[model samples]
Target chain A: MIKRRKFSEALFKALGLSALVLAVGTLVLLFGALLIDGVGRLDWQFLTSFPSRHASQAGILPAVVGSTLVMLVTAFVGIPIGVAAAIYLEEYARRTWLTELIEVTVTNLAGVPSIIFGLLALGLFVYMLGLGSSILTAGLTLALLILPVVIVTTREAIRAIPVQIREAAFALGATRWQTVADHVLPYSASGILTGIILALSRAIGETAPIVTVGALTFIAFLPPSPITDQPPYLSFEWLMSPFTVMPIQMFGWVSRPGEDFAANAAAAGLLLVGMTLAMNGLAIYVRYRMRKRVSW
Target chain B: MARPVDGPYIDSAGRGDWPKPLKAETCELSFYYGTRLVLKRVSVPIAECNITALIGPSGCGKSTFLRCFNRMHDLYPGTRYEGAIVLYPDSRNILDREVDPIEVRMRLAMVFQKPNPFPKSVYENVAYGLRVRGVKDRRAIDEKVEQALRSAALWEEVKDRLSALGTSLSGGQQQRLCIARALATDPELLLLDEPTSALDPIATASIEELLQDLKRRVTILIVTHNMQQAARISDWTAFMYLGELVEFGPTKRLFTTPAKKQTEDYITGRFG
Candidate 1:
């Protein structure tokens, strides 16, 4: 009986070790494959030059610029509104049926597939509003796709704040708004920023929604000039003009039959990975600082 | 013991000796949570710059009654109250539907049982009340924060680390820091609900001493479950039982010879 028990315990330990090894091995293999194919094709011209129709002529410059623009626009449009909605729901709203319903809706929205948000943007911005398939429409779609995530993360961050802090603020002759702005918001700012970065990272890699919203597969020019033009300027108008982001261009490359196209796809994937990793690292660092600052 | 034949004790309930008029006057104030009534119709005159201590057992209504001063009862959805809580003779009654509870809180400051510093630097924590009041001058803010910290007896320890976070302080220091935060606004009345209950004996002694010093400048109403604490710090003591204010008088009389049997029994620990 003692021997059997020892054998079973050993078996369990072995199983656990094997599971961990498998997970690590899978990640390393995936990264190794990407690097092996991607490192050979990467160069300054590839990064700085515009996309071309031929595999030899193609570069990721326009796609990179387009992605950066869309990501910034998405961050600007999504973060404040998401955080404000979260603050309102968590801090100010009474526990009525309406608030409960809103909470439920937000949770459900987070679970809804990203593709649905794209379809919604297509119908509303493209067809109904006549904004057409442009960078603005794509950004808005991406923002919608990630809004619930940002709201949920921000709400959790705000909710983690002790009620005593709010009480202390109120006890100091501060109005409710004052208490929220001065005490609650400052304390939660780091956490909220971390959440925004994470949400933006998620938005950056998304291709399904933008695709459904009709993101251009190829574009030769940068966005319409943001400041120089009046209304509807194509030179810097991210909101109104056709644009091709890195992920969309990468998808097009990967689907083609040529080895050069596959190499370019791998290079673009590497860039996408680098962008997301940078965002994730920043989010993690901010979260760490916030933890230290808020530590009791 | 002989009662003082002279001084304001004889006219304790009169209007002329009262300073700042009455900010809040509770008459026959009784509170109930569900079917359990926590405070009986207990009347007490809360005077400015005088410290009043409410002493009772664990379940007694001292803390609940203290909460009533700022209309904090509104925060809890199910808790209800009866009788009158009149605010600043000119303002509407607290129980009236028209009065905003937020306005009441703006006049009264409260320190809690535990030290709850917001997750902010010590400087930000002290400047918080001032900033909320829209004081924009950097020099004035720096001066007021120093003054408030000094008054709370924490400036010497914290002056160099003003930018350091509030949570980095020792437990006693955090409680004192909270006191400083409360003092920054110069509130009409300061409510301390077992402010030292969670501290060690040494920390408790420091907070007790600070409370004694603070009473000379601020109107203080403290709720304490410790009979000895009530005796040590309070100028006047109000003994409560269950939900009723059994007896109230000078601290010496209340501790030495309580007016009611319930008060004596509670003080002696015969029964809570």
Candidate 2:
């Protein structure tokens, strides 16, 4: 009997190890292929110049700029609203049927298809609101797509804080706001940041939602200068300008019947993966600092 | 043993000085968490500059009773407080809706069962109460932080490393740091809910010794499960059973000759 149990354990161990190896090995192969194909194409000029009909002359400048601006909008619009909703749900809201319903809905929302969010943005922000195929509409759509992820992560972070810590603060005569501001927010900051970055990274690679919201596959001109030489020295005109993000641009290149376009798509894919990894690295660094200070 | 009629049980048989002057007293304080009544109508007197320890078995509402003094129960919804926790000098009913819980907490401080120090520096942890109260002057905050740490008997070990994170300390040191945080505001009353329950024996001993020194200035009310700890540290003791105050008297009298049978049974380890 013992021999049989040992054999079973060994078999399970081997199965698990094989599974892990398969998954990691696939990722390594894909990344290695992208590196080999795209490395020669990457250059300063390729980054700085705009896209063209000629594949060799094409640069990801406009697409890169578009993605950055859209992400900025998503972070600005989604993060505060998501964080606030989470705080309200976790801290202030009483446990009732309505709150429970809301919780269930939010959890389910995170699992909803990204294309569904795109359709919603198409109907609401595009046609109904008359925002057209602009940067703002695409940003708002991505924001909606990631809202559930942000809220879920923020709530998880807030919930992880020990009740004793809150009691200690309250015992010191801190008001609810004071306690949240001084202890809760500062302590949960790393977890919230990790969640935010993860959500943003997820939004960055999204193509269908931005496409549904009316992002152009090809764009030559840049959005209006955000920093004009005017007295205010700031502008919001770019928000309303037509845009194309990295994923959409890559998709357009990949569909073309040419080896050069395929290489272009590979380069863009490499950049997208790099961006996501950089975000994840930032999250890890932040979480490390927070964990060192505020452990229970 | 003589039982005082219609008031808190005070067995002043062995001691000549019976009343030590009331810092605060609860008048039939009953607490309810939703529909379940946790703390029944229990009247208890906290003597000024004296350490009163509430001893009871687990789930007997001793911790719940401790939380009542600072209106800590008000933090949650559906938990209700009935009756009065009247503070001296002002004689204001802290349980009254008119009286703010935050205001009551400012007058009193609490140390929890587990040491809960903020992730901030030792200096900032000690200065937390002052910061909440809006004491912004750097010199004043520095002086108070030192004084509070010294009062908690943690200054010598942590004086040079004031900027170190509070959680970086040993378990006992963290508890003492919590005590320092509570003391920084110079509260009228200090509430401790099993402050040393999570510590080692040596750390527990140090904290008990510190409490003895502290009772000279601040009135303390502590809830402890260890009967020996109550006997060693507290001047007054209240034995609670099933959410009711069974006996309240001087520590010496209560430990040796408890007026009630329940107190005797629990004290002698007959049953909890």
Candidate 3:
């Protein structure tokens, strides 16, 4: 019996190691291929320039700018809504079927595919709301796609907070909102921030939803800045301006007949990977600092 | 640094101090966590300016009884309370359906066994109570924080590091900070649930000494597992067994010569 148990244990270890190798090995190979193809193509000029009919002249400036702006809008809309929903779920919501229903919905929504969210944006924001195929429409759609992720992370963060902190605050006569806004939220802020950054990174790489929302495959001009002035003025019309993000641009390139555009796609892919890694790094740092700050 | 505290202390000390002004009183109070009745009908008088210690073995509902004073159990739904917890001056039944737990908590502050300080500077931890009560002036907050810390006997240890995070302190210091936080608001009653169970011997002694000093200023109700601790600092001791009040009286007499057979057995190292 002992010999049989040993054999099973050895088999299990081999299976687990093979699975790990398969996953990591694939990621490394793909990243290695992108590095070789894209490194020579990357440059300040390539970063600064806009797309062109000639693949060599094509740069990802508009897509980069568009992605950055869209990500900002996503953060602006998603984080507040997500955090509020999370606070209600974890703090204020009584243990009732209604609260349970909301929780179940959020859990299910988190598992929905990104492309479905794109279709949702296409229908709701673009067509029904008459927002057109604009940066705002794409951003709003991406925000919807990521809201579940943000809310899940935020709820997890708030839930992980020791019950004693809440009890301490309430014991000192803080109202529920005061306890949450003053003590609970501040303590879990790093976790919330890390969640947001990770969610934004998810949105950053999303191509299907942005494309589904009708972002142009190629764009040569920057969307007008959301802040500009004739005098003491700011403009929001850029929110309605057409745009393309990095993944959409990259997808467009990789699908073309020519090898040059494929090379262009590889370079854009490298940049996208770099941005995602930077965001993940920041998230990890925030979590580390928060852990160091709070012993309990 | 002066702030208004509980009014007119009629000292509840000395055997013949007749009809002490009560801070709070519980009458036939029982508590339930769902359908399970954890605290049987318990009646006890909490005298102003004295420390009343609740002593019992684990799960005897001493903590639950202490939490009843401030309605701490309100955070969880389906946990119900029976009978009355009356605050003396207002004579309001704190368990009344219409009473706000928040307001009840303001009048009665609490500290837990484990020190839980917000992830802010020590100064912020003490000032939190005042800020919640709308004391916004920075100078006033600073003064009160200092006073409260001083009252808790932690000011000397933490004076130079007020800006340091509350969690940065030793476990004992953090517990003291929690006490200071409670004191900052000057609640009429302070509830401590095993405040020193997590502390080292020296830390426990310091807190016990502080508690002795604190009883002269504000009424305190404490839950302790240590019989000697109850004997040491508490003016009145109530012994509980199986969610029922076994006996209660002045601490010295209760420990030296308990009234009931159960109390005697429990205090004499017999099976709890």
Candidate 4:
């Protein structure tokens, strides 16, 4: 019986290892394929030039800038709201049916389809509010899309703090806000930042939501500069400009019946993947630094 | 002193004669969690500059009684405090609705079962209480941090690495840091809930020694599971069982003389 148990354990171990290998193997394969198809087109000119009818001359400059600005807007709009909501729900909210219902709704919202968010944005931002098919609308759409991700992660991070830490602070005569500001926020900072970065990375790759918000398929012009040469230099005009994102640009190219457009799509996909990886890397670095400073 | 310091004596009423002036005392203090009663009318006297140790078996609500002094139960919902935890001199009921828990906490400090230093520098950990009170003067904070660490018997070892993370220390040192954190505020009463329960013998010995010295500076109320620890460290010992104060008297008398049958049974390890 012992020998049979040992054999079964060995079998289960092998099965788990193979499952891990299968998961990682697929990612490696996809990355390898992107490199093979897109590496040739991924150069300085491709990065700097605008999209054109000729796939060879076409560049992702507008899409890259658009994606960056839209991401900026999304971060600005989403992070505070998400973290605040998370803090309120986790720390301040009393356990009642209303709060429970809100919690359940927030969690369920994270599982809702991305396309549904796009449809919501289309009706809400495009027509009802009339924000138009602009950078602001696209940003708002993506922000809504990633709100659940941010809130869930922030809540998870806050919940990770040991109760003793808070108790110690409270015992020291710290008020609730003081305890939260001094100990809770500082202790859970690394987790919250990691969550924010991961959520942003998720936001960066989103295509369906932005498209549903009416992002342009092709764009050659850049948004107005955020800083001006004149007094009161900061500008909000860029937020109102029509824009295209990396995914939408790639999606547009991938639809056309040509190897050249397909190459462009592949190259754009590669850069998007690189951006996502870089954000995730930053999240990991932040977590490592935080863990080094304050481990329970 | 308002109250004369007489030698230890157990009166006819079975209550120990308090030798020193009272720092605080709970009068018919009953605590409830939701509908269930836990600490049932526990009225233990905490003498000023004395170590009053509460010894009970697990789940006897000794820790719950300790928490009542600082209103720690108020952090959760549905826990009710009945009767009064009266602070001396001022003669104010700390558990009264008008009395803020934060105000109570400011005058009192607590050390937990496990070392719970903040995820900040050792200096910052020790300085946190002052910071919350808005004592922003750098030099004042530094002096208090040093003084607290010194009192906790951890200054010499950690003076060089004040900027080091509090959690980076050994378990014994971390507990000392927590004590230093509590001491930094110059609290009138120190509540320690099994502070050395999680430590090794060597660490526990050092903490016990520190607590003995600390009683001269501030009133201490500690809860310990180890009867020997209670015997070794406390001036007064309150033996509790099933959420009731079974016996309370001078440590020597409680350990030796028969106060009650249950206290004797538990002290002799008849059953928890």
Give me the candidate number with maximum TM-score.
2
> Where in model 2 is the C-alpha error above 4 Å?
A1-3, B1-5, B8-18
Give the per-residue lDDT digits (tens) of candidate 4, residues A1-296: 99999999999999999999999999999999988899999999999989999999999999999999999999999999999999999889999999999999999999999999999999999999999999999889889988998899999999999999999989988888888888888888999999999989998999888888888989989999999989799999999999999999999999999899888999999999999999999999999998787689
lDDT of 3 by residue, B111-172 (tens): 99899988899999999999899998999998999999999999999999899999889999
Q: Which candidate should be chosen as best, given lDDT against the real structure?
A: 2
Model 3 spans > 4 angstroms off: A1-18, B1-19
Query: Clashing pairs in model 3?
Result: none
**Could you give candidate 1's per-residue lDDT for residues B1-272 as a string of tens digits?**
12123323223343223334445556778888877888878766565577788888887788899988777877766788887776554655666667677777767778899999876788888888888778999999999999999888999999999988899998889998998988887877889999998899998998888888887887888999888998998877777778887766778777886656788888899987
lDDT of candidates 1 onward, in order: 0.81, 0.91, 0.88, 0.91
What is candidate 2's DockQ? 0.79
The residue pairs in collision within model 1 are A223-A235, A223-A236, A224-A234, A224-A235, A224-A236, A224-A237, A225-A235, A225-A236
For the second chain, the TM-scores of the candidates in order are: 0.87, 0.95, 0.92, 0.95
Given candidate 2, what's the lDDT at residue A69?
97
lDDT of 4 by residue, B183-211 (tens): 99999999999999899999999999999
Select the stronger candidate by TM-score from 1 and 3. 3
Q: What is the TM-score of each predicted model, taking all chains together? A: 0.90, 0.96, 0.93, 0.94
TM-score for chain A, candidates 1 onward in order: 0.94, 0.98, 0.96, 0.95
Model 3 vs. true fold: TM:
0.93
Interface RMSD of each: 1.7, 0.9, 1.1, 0.8
Ranking the candidates on DockQ from highest down gives 2, 4, 3, 1
Which runs in model 1 stand beyond 4 Å of their true positions?
A1-3, A227-236, B1-24, B34-36, B86-96, B138-140
